[model samples]
Target: FKNAGFYRTVRKNNQPNNNFKIEVIQGGLFSDEEIKKHPGIRHETTQETGIKHLDGTISMARNEPGTASTEFFICIGNQPELDFGGKRNADGQGFAAFGKVIKGMDVVRKIQQLPDENQYLKEPVRIISMNIR
Candidate 1:
């Protein structure tokens, strides 16, 4: 997902009950066409890992247990609420955190500042290439 387009970017929580304030830039599930073209692939949700979704952290986005595949998000700030038992999801089974940004956080914040409508970016900021080390 190094070059995937960001689909969702939110500053805070406005949803009822699910008000676990968070800032994130989610990508991987682009558009309907993209979904149709590359149907969402499912893989086992790896658990028991004690990774936390801190600022610049990268984690998989899922609906439920074992529902994550390609969808992932970058936490704009320390998002402990996205860890195990987080209230953002009804299941409280937070996302599967895997990695983090070692540099270029300024770019991540810039992406967070991009105009968004109801949590979705008006115009996605896509990376042409990303180096992972």
Candidate 2:
């Protein structure tokens, strides 16, 4: 629900052509222990829901397959590798995709561009509030 960190744009080797390169952009959420400690928090993984990680998709962040707590991430690009059976993780369960950005993608991109050292944002962005409609 808030900006915890951002993934720096890095050049990855093109699989088809070793000499070619592609940029991969990614980002992460700010975890709040207070939120995680809330009595209402659910530590379970819930159903798979068969969702895929497309651009702007919001998904729960987990260390293992079923350990997602309050952390989450928003896809800055089509991250099929983060979807179920994705290659991004060894377990291959992938992150739980739940929501998509309806607007303000520019703001998201701007935040993604913030300076980062070793993949950690130099200045972590904060979420003052969140509302559900």
Candidate 3:
């Protein structure tokens, strides 16, 4: 995901229908054009990885407990409602949290502040490139 991902959508505490202070920005090949560019990929949800959704947490974005894929999000604040048994989802299945932001939090926060309509960013942030040590 280092080079194949882009900052996609975002959810803040102000969004309607939200009951908790949830703030997250989802990322991946969301657009159809982008999805076609990166084809034949797989990510199994399996189960909810137990980890409190604190600031800077990175996790997989899924509709159901078994449908996780390449899409991921970064937590902005201590979003406990995203945890298992939380109110974010009705099924009690939380997101698949695997890591946290080691750096570039300033950049992440800036993404959250971008203009969005119904949680979708107006100008999607492009991932120039990335490398893992």
Which residue ranges in model 2 land beyond 4 Å of their true spot?
1-47
When sorted by TM-score, best at the front, the candidate numbers are 1, 3, 2
Best model number under lDDT: 1
- Model 1: CA > 4 A from native: 13-17, 32-47
Q: Residue 118 of model 3: what lDDT? A: 79
lDDT scores for all predictions? 0.75, 0.58, 0.71
Candidates in order: C-alpha RMSD to true structure: 2.8, 5.5, 3.5
Better of 1 and 3 by TM-score: 1
RMSD of candidate 3 to the truth, in angstroms, is 3.5
Tens digits of per-residue lDDT for model 2 on 21-123?
2233344444456445533323222134756677777777667754665666777777777766666667766777777878877877787666666555576
lDDT of 1: 0.75
- lDDT tens digits by residue: candidate 3, 10-126: 565447676664788888777666545543424322243456788998877777765666677889988777777677888776776778888898999888888877787877887
Between prediction 1 and prediction 3, the one with superior lDDT is 1
lDDT of 2 at 30: 40
